[model samples]
Target: MVLSLMNKDKFLHVVKVSMESSPYFQLVSSSDAYRAVPPGASAPVRIRFTPSKNRDYCHELVCLTARERIVVPIRAIGARAVLNFPAQLDFSKCPVKVSTQQTLLVRNVGARAARYQLRTQSPFSVVPATGALGAGDTVQVTVAFHPLASGAHCGSLAVCCSSGEERIHTKLQGEAVDVIVGLSTNSMEFDRTFTTMSSHRTLFIENKSNITAHFQWKAFAAEKEENEEKRRQCLLRPPKEVPQENFPEEKETEKVKGFCGDHSALLSSMDQEKMAKVKLMNQGAIDAPFTCLPSATNLGLLFKFAPEEGIIAAGGSQAVQISFRATVLGSFEEELQFSVAGSPRPAILTIKGSVTAPSLHFDLAELDFGDISFGFPYTQRCRLTSSSAVPLTFQLRMSDDGTQPAVDSVDQIRRDSDPAWSKGIHLHVEPREFTINPSGGTILPQGHQDIEVTLCSNTVMEFYRRLLVDLEGIGKGVAALIITARYQPLPGLPQALPCPGCAGCSCQGEVLLNALMLCQLDTRTAVLGQQPVVKSTFAPSPARSWALF
Candidate 1:
């Protein structure tokens, strides 16, 4: 019971409160609970009554102020049934059209018997919808979930009593899922690729269900399985045809199992030519600079798929690329598996390719800068291509003498000025001169790198040198670019004007054009006044010094 205490006096006053109580009654607030009240102001106080048995209970609340005293009565007639129930219910992740159930513990925790009526909407139902319980009685109420559609859904379950006069509500929600997914194809084949080169192919994922699905790419097959397959193939092939070192056997008899007496004689005459070119390179040899650098790599790490994990929407598709790259020389094959939610089994994909040494070459084997003009730069555009499927890591070096490795002798060469744009070798002699832009770098598989080769000379002399591309991981072969040019002073113009008519007059572009033509083409003029060459004459070009740009 609660009542307000008002200060009837025209001034401020303090109100004091006291409760005459029983075991079933309580003072909701401490005595002196409502102390200060301004003139014409009021404050509230409360008294509580609780019954331990089905019997009547009463309590008195006394309020005292500076002006008056009052008494407030608090009462509890009887105890009715109070319930104990779960705060909320959840039916986590159930398949559509399927039923999932959870129990709701309903108990009568008060003094009297009670009957509960369960009510909720479709896709959710409660068992023993109406049940009576004695005082302190407990029942296990079954709540079933029937998902009508995919995705998250919500509803409410009502526990009603006394014609809904007293009721309790619990939340209802669940995740409805229907997953169906697959791949466009079950197998893949890669192109023949060179070692250290990357070759890739694309496959698609198809989601056929109404709900979104998650997918993952994995390599499920073990190396032991691959060895078993190799071993089986070894037994089927004849000893002479099989690569003996590639597949080892547990028993020695397996190596010569099917080899008859005459077949053993065939093995004795081993092919000496097969191992003929296994000699180490000699640095002193003239062609030593053309040799490629060697490389090593792990085989297990050779194959990989891009965009490792992702989601696929309902009735949607995604494309994924699988790539292969190797550091060793031989044939290689690897297996990959694709697994997704709702699929009974993972999809198997095979990746197989051959890895050979890198084969890199320029479009042209040589660059000829015919006639060089002093103080002017002659430039040539060159394209370096990787024919094999592997990358080409290289070093571009300029050679004074075409027979030696120039990259290692960089410290021995001296230069007063270095071209800041030149990446590798920068030093050049008075006339054996050439510089490369982006002197050293890498090239992608089946890709090309564009570079500019600039040749310049200050002295009048002939120049002969080579530009070497030392490719990494190449067992043997040459990537050499030969350069040849001769520096010549511009030919002097005739002292007398070729056109006699312009001798005493101001010189025009025609006179200069004719003089240039006479000096370059060695043409003798025969009174061709103000007439240009029948065929167009070009200026000195970077490609050919005699032909102009």
Candidate 2:
């Protein structure tokens, strides 16, 4: 038997010995595998003879061969590839490639390793890197591409594997970032020295950019100056064919001075939120919204003054005086945004100040009144009187000391009404004593004693006899006893003796010596030179005996 194998096909040989037939060996050749048929049709050899040589001997030999037809279904072995970036990458400068040696990570996700190569399309190239990756193994690779000049870039990395070719395509898109630079107009005058001034501005690269932007700050004395003819009109205005040219001789108005003029580095790394902190400072004396290197570009957003940014205490108000240098002279506008970071509302602050008003109010403070006393009534009067000014009517209310009463009375002491000359008058007096003695005495303008009240009483008596004198409105007053009290005792006994037995009498046991006598003093007396004398008389008590009486 002979057997051979082909590139993609298999061959087999078979030998069989049949026990029920004449013993014989047969051979078969495999050919035209696509067009072959079954082997069950060949008949077995049969031999018949007389039973003379031996007692009916029978034998069958069978040869068997089998070969499987090779029919394999090839399958690819990879998953979707991914790329991660820390920040937004500039597609114009990034590396990309297609299937040919694309130096990037490749991994096989199926049960086997993938033998593959890399290639690239336009604007991309693959480095000298190749890899055969297993199910989970990743390969590092390098790709180089002349990034897109502007706008979005797209391409694909084709992976040619042993099974077949699979495409892993990638697209990169980006936007152009303008390079920003800082500028300053150190000092500009509103008065015209030149008919027009032009600022030559330059730019610095930022955010990995190659873009350059040009700006011109043209100071026009008047609107008509923009069209005025000049000997250097060709330089001032670009040639029709060369509109991109820049003229530096147009006298750049110094530079727009910053808050801290020399330290422009403070503005270099500013973000959109931080650049907002820079503004048209000291605007009242200048044409502000100060022109920067990128003139029309809104690089300087309004400063956001948050309620929390300035020291707005729970009880105290906050005043933000964003100071700046006097960089130029003209009417201008300064704007700031007052906002809360996480809040949706925004406030605009447009303040006006001037260099002519440049006096530093270095300190601003407050007067705090904490925990004041309410027990005692107090009046603090500040009097600023202009002599020529008319006298204003003041209504006065009375207050209390710890021991006094609170009274509200209108005291209209005018310049013409009896008493006039005085200042803010606060009076504290004892409580009212109208029943015992009249209170609240007033003296005229000329220091003179006018009215005096006398109160007299015996040591044993609780009540006092009062005498009152009124000299309140008396001018050039003469001191006098305008009122007096005279004692005129009625006709009565001069004295009384103890009567111990009497229910309401004194403790002494002596009986009443004499009944109370009434003494009479007559005003119509006869004697010319004698003072009036009392005439004594006795009155008898009805309730007592003669001895006791």
Candidate 3:
């Protein structure tokens, strides 16, 4: 509240300004006695009120002057429902994938009940969506923060009362770090001849701190379930004739299974030619039986590491060997997780590369249509080139598979079969509407072909679709084209006008059009000139003003 004082005389001297007698009100600004106020000038006093009960509060601002004494009254009513929360919840430096929780309290200080709903953004969630509190009742609400990626994440948690009378918000902040074990490289690549020869790469694991760190490492192949299913289906199909050059010699067939003498011997061998032959023989044997080896369990067969597990001294580093051999010709991606002994979070390193064969090649991994307006159609094109020496036949089909994993709700995520509520967004794809030109055809060696895909959406939402391309005959390779799109509503729709006979309403349509045009012109001018444009006003008719009853 502001208390204003006006001096009508030539000059007024303020002796003191005090609120010492009032317990509920206090002056927020420092007051100076003997301050001179010039004639015809005003002075303001700022005061704050702190109410302890839900009742009328009154206080007096007393001013003692050389000429006279002034007393000003101030009054306010305390609210019934008060939401008490901290200004911010700081979960100082947390490890990645770890969750931390904080509690907020809401109290009802009056004679009535209060109902409130809690809302927060991604990476932050409340336990209960809504709750009710009786008179003099208090409830606790839990706010959780779970970091999905390594970085600084922040958002807000808001509590809104049902009466729309009060809204309280608090900032949520957390930093995710994975600094215990530092890796030399997060990614590794293999040459095109991965199937015939084994490639070796070394990664240095260094302890970032001065403390002795005990670390454990493991390699996991991504999309194991999907890869298993694809492998099973491929094995069930008819076997194609193996090329003579690609086939293993009959003499060295028995040694394929145990070609790598022992883990230690294999790690010590420096003969690149012998190891290449061993890898080629093992891959040919696995392919001959129409069986694919799962990379997850076959890591031991493909790779040999010296000192697989150990402890690193303070600020020490160790070099670990990572060997790669591809049993099947395609793209392979794996994740290496390094975890400290006592830490709940692990640092992830990704390893990915393609083992190219004599087959078709696509330049892009996925297609993004960006944002499109509802009822509008969009078309995108991609090229497929034949990298083999022979002609390749391919078939194209659209898949109505499940939606991709959503990272938006990383904090409130639950299992699909969990009893908790689940929200899913699905995209409908019509085989007839999503057309591909020259759906199935053959391309000559070293030749290229263009494929066009047209998409349209009738709803304003995000969507995801997959286009599966299958190569015919010998290779029987499969490629997936992930398509994503977001549709939005058109802009610049007319707003609702006031009732014709209501107050501030004008019956003349020209007046309304002129007002809108003026507003648009002012906005455009302001944007172009980087300055405020003066606005013109239209006086309302006297009849319209009198229509308010």
TM-scores for every predicted model: 0.26, 0.18, 0.25
Ranking by lDDT: 1, 3, 2
Highest TM-score model number:
1
Report the C-alpha lDDT of model 3 over 328-399, residue by residue, as the tens digit. Answer: 555555554444333233323344545545556677888888875433357899988876655667888767
Locate the minimum summed-lDDT window of 10 residues in model 1. 261-270
Give the whole-model CA lDDT for all candidates, comma-separated.
Answer: 0.56, 0.29, 0.54
Which residue ranges in model 3 land beyond 4 Å of their true spot? 1-80, 179-549
* Tens digits of per-residue lDDT for model 1, 1-549: 667777765568777888754677677787556578888998877666666667656677887864457887775666567778676788888877778899867789877777778898888898988888888889998999988678998888887765225687888988987656778999999999999999999989998876555667744345567645543443354424434356544432343222111000000011101111111111110111111111133543544444454544322234454444445566655544444433333333344545555577888877888886644567887888877544567778777533322221122122213332122232242234466898878887688888888775533457777778776545323587777887764477432223344434433445565546655432322222454422112212222222121
How high a TM-score does candidate 2 get? 0.18
RMSD of each: 37.1, 47.1, 27.4
Of the two candidates 1 and 2, the one with more favorable TM-score, higher being better, is 1
Q: Candidate 1: where is the Cα deviation over 4 Å?
A: 1-354, 401-432, 473-477, 493-518, 521-549
TM-score of 1: 0.26
